[model samples]
Target: MTPLGTAVTAGTERAWIEFRRGFTNATDLGFYVVMSVVVFAILWFNRDTVVQVPGYELPSATYALPSFVGGLIAFLSVLGVAYALAMEREDGTLLRAKSLPHGMTGYVVGQVLRTTLETIAGLTLALVPAMLFIDGILVDGVGGLVWLPAILVLGLLATLPIGVVIGAVVRSVRQVNTWGSLPLFALIWASGIFVPTIALPQWARVVGQLFPVYWLGLGTRAVLLPDEAAALEIGGSWRPGWTVAVLVAWAVAGVLVAVPILKRMAARESGSAIAERRERALQRTY
Candidate 1:
């Protein structure tokens, strides 16, 4: 078999092993399940609140749930991958992988696949519950059954590799908070995920629109919200085409950026590098 093919096969096996391992560990599974709970609780708290948009109104919980889902997916994908890579890098995991032929590729592929599965499982916990209990969700009904999964797959494609790239670029796990999580948090806040874009400042709106998160939230809202909820958006429309265009662009660019950087990152890994990383991490802790 070709080297790449062998790596992929190995990676798939690794992902399955990790995913199943997660299922057996209650603490880990419980921790992952908390996101869904927190999100659902947020929605439940505002379940009855109504918001007045230009020509329409919606229950805030109903309105926010979809955006929250999209934001959470991006948040989890980026931070999760970033932190894992950073921690593994510090602890000699990447160094070990570097000793194997094509192991970096397998490692990257495994991380991506495993995280995607985890994200899907985590979100399903929130979505299925919210669908059952929250009013005005699944607004498109049967059609939503189609659109929701399609949007999720696209959003994952768009965001996961961004995570990979971020993971590759950061020097250490500690830096991930500063370089990856904080920036992502700021980006989501600027985007319309937590609040309506119409209410954000003009520059914030412009900045939010520049990234994939905004489009992801927009796309999810398009499905989970009523058609008129589009009025609450920046242009007073859903712009489904724009959502697809932006996400696809990000997916392509993220892969291009992540691959070479990840290769460079793996190339630099060594026992000495990991020891230096740990020493620095220890100094920071002390």
Candidate 2:
């Protein structure tokens, strides 16, 4: 195989290994279980309440559930990348990669796969239960046939690169918690995850619409919610064109920006730098 092909193949293999390791790790498995329980509680608590969206009537849980799922994708994509990069940097994983020819390519590809698979694993925990118990999720219809998969794929493409950029820029794992988690939570709240964007003040709603999280939530709702639910959305339509356009725009922009940043970050990685970080981390632990 050519050098590029060899790197990609190695990356793919590394991703599989990481995926298996992630599922087997006790801490990681427990985290997934806890998240599943949390998501189930959210679904169960809201199941019986019928939310009166301006022109529609549906179980409030049904309305909130899918949007929450969509928002989770963005959250996982960004926070996962950020935390993984930061932790690996501290542990000298990136420095090791810097030692091999074309290793950075493999490292990045493995990360993309790892984050995607891990997020899917987490999603399944909530999604399987939601489908079995919830009433309004579109399991078998035109929606199930088409829009559901399309929106999911688009959502991943749009959000994953942005996550990588955040991961590349963060200086430490703690900063990921502070800088990454705080803004993401704020976005989730502002993006109408728990309520309709239409209900937010005009400016707040507009601010929410500016980001991919709101569009992801909106697209998921479009796939699952009935036509009348569109009444609660801006523009009173699914606006598939806009959804695709916005996500694609972010995807393109993220890739364009992440490449240079990642190269710069990788260039700075060295044995001495890794040792310094390790020493600092060890000192903190002591």
Candidate 3:
């Protein structure tokens, strides 16, 4: 086989192995189960409360549901990947990757596949049941079925590389929560995940719009809600074209930045550096 083909085959195997290991790990499994329950509980509590959305006969959960799903997509793509990368780096996983032929290539491919599948799994666990049981959540029917998956894939591309860059730059696993996860929660809150952009102050809405979280939520809403529901959105339209444009731009820019940054990070992964990190971790533990 060609060297490229060999690498692709190795990467695919690595991705599958990693995915299986992750799902089977006790901690990871527990976290998934707990998060699934939390998500369903939130949806259940909100199921009965109806909000007045213009041109929509259903409750507010119709809008909230898509936004919630979109927010989870953004969170998983960014903070989830970043946390995993940081932990791997501290534990010498990156160093091991650097030692093998074309290991970085395979590792990156595995990571991308892992995170993408994880995001889809999250949606399946949390959002699919809501759509099936809840009334008025997905009113756009066949069109939504097509566009929702498209936007989700685009959202993953746009946000996943940002996480890669963050992981390459973060100093330690502990720092991921501080610099990556915390700020993501802040973005989710401001991005109109739980509220309409129209209800936010003008400046606040502008600030939210600067990030991908808002756009992801907006795109999801566009796919799931009725046309008249666009009246509730800022600019009174879904702006699907602009959503795709911005997400694509982010994906391109993030790839350009992440490649160089990841290269540098990989280059710096020496045995001594890994030992020092291990020593520091031991010291903190004792």
Candidate 4:
């Protein structure tokens, strides 16, 4: 390996160690376990009500579960990574990492990888209950099953750069939490997660189309629902091809914007400056 590659690898290893420590410390595993049970319970209790909608026939709960879980995973994963970045900035840890070889790229890669793994695990846990309780939810044909993982990976890739950008720009944990919640809610609402985009007002539909969430939901619905169901109209006319293209475009655009921002953030994160700020804060408190 080239020296840069070696340094990147070593930095990735260190980042992984830190990630594991934080993951365990946060007891995220336990959170996922409890959440899975709760989500299944909700689905079970509401299945009859959910099926009552006219002209809305679903295959199995298992097939429907992944998109819901995936949406949630995407939101939380991005928020978590952003929060981590803000904390690292405050703690001077990011500055320390910068002093190491290939530290910036390796640290960024490790965070993205760790966050992606967490999202996958959470989504998988969500699917188990969906399979057990929601009948006819699994992929209908062998073809769908074979392609499911590939689609999911693409979906994950689509969300990663947005997460990185959120992480890079937010100045504080409080700001991240407050501002982040707005987009999360907006995306979920606009994406037709609870209500079909067709049902939304014209202005809302116009606004929703500008975001990746709409495309993500549209692509997911195309994959999970029957062709006839997918044929249902949205934002005037329904087109799966347009949905896929839009989502891919969003993902590409997000990456293009995030990389330079991350580099800029890294350049600005000086250990001495962070330490001085902390000292001043401490003095003011005393």
lDDT of 3: 0.83
What order do you get sorting by TM-score, best first?
2, 3, 1, 4
Indicate whether candidate 1 or candidate 2 has the larger TM-score.
Answer: 2
Ranking of candidates on lDDT, top first: 1, 2, 3, 4
Work out the TM-score per prediction. Answer: 0.93, 0.95, 0.94, 0.85
lDDT of 3 at 278: 88
By summed lDDT, the worst window of 10 consecutive residues in model 4 runs over: 51-60
* Candidate 2 runs further than 4 Å off: 139-144
Q: Kindly list the per-residue Cα lDDT of model 4 for residues 1-286, writing each as its tens digit.
A: 9868976787567657765765576576678777778778766766664322246565434333544754665675777678778778888878877887777777777777777766766777766656666654445688667556555666666777777787778766667866676787777776666555666777877887787666666666665665555534373344756766776787788788988998898898886778776886678679
lDDT of 1 at 275: 79
Query: Candidate 1 lDDT (Cα, whole model)?
Result: 0.85
Better of 1 and 3 by TM-score: 3
lDDT of 3 by residue, 1-286 (tens): 8755676678788778877887889998787778778877887888777766665555666768889888999988897779878988988888887777778887888788889888888778777777766765554668778888888988999899989988989989888888888888888888889887888878878888888788899999888776777877888999999998888888899899998999999999988998899899899999
Per lDDT, the best of the predicted structures is 1
Best by TM-score: 2
TM-score of 2: 0.95
**Candidate 1 ranges beyond 4 A from true positions:** 139-144, 284-286
Clashes of each: 0, 0, 1, 4
Model 3: per-residue Cα lDDT at residue 33: 78
